[model samples]
Target: MGGRVLGYGTYHVLTHLTSTELYSHCELVRNKLVPLK
Candidate 1:
């Protein structure tokens, strides 16, 4: 039970981190590709 809970939490954390990283990467690319105001 504990192991399952830990695994679930870890999976969610990794997913969140990956999503955050992806968003940041997209933002960076957009900033570089798009002109500033």
Candidate 2:
């Protein structure tokens, strides 16, 4: 019902936020590393 839809929406938002945070962390680490050919 409506509650189930809300729960799913919240879950999706959390999942997206987690992935975005992970991606930013990875980018940060990469920026700190020395580049090689």
- Winning candidate number (TM-score): 1
The positional error of residue 25 in candidate 2, measured at the CA in angstroms, is: 0.2
TM-score of each: 0.90, 0.87
Candidate 2, residues 1-37: lDDT per residue as tens digits?
9999999999999999999999999998888784742
Task: Kindly give the stretch of ten consecutive residues in candidate 2 with the minimal lDDT sum.
Answer: 28-37
Clashes within 3 Å, all models in order: 0, 0
- Evaluated against the true structure, the overall lDDT of model 2 is 0.93
Q: TM-score of model 1 relative to the true fold?
A: 0.90
Which structure among the candidates has the greatest lDDT?
Answer: 1
What's the lDDT of the predicted structure labeled candidate 1?
0.97
- Superposed Cα RMSD, model 1: 2.0
Query: lDDT (CA) for every model shown?
Result: 0.97, 0.93
1-37: candidate 1 lDDT, tens digit per residue? 9999999999999999999999999999999888864
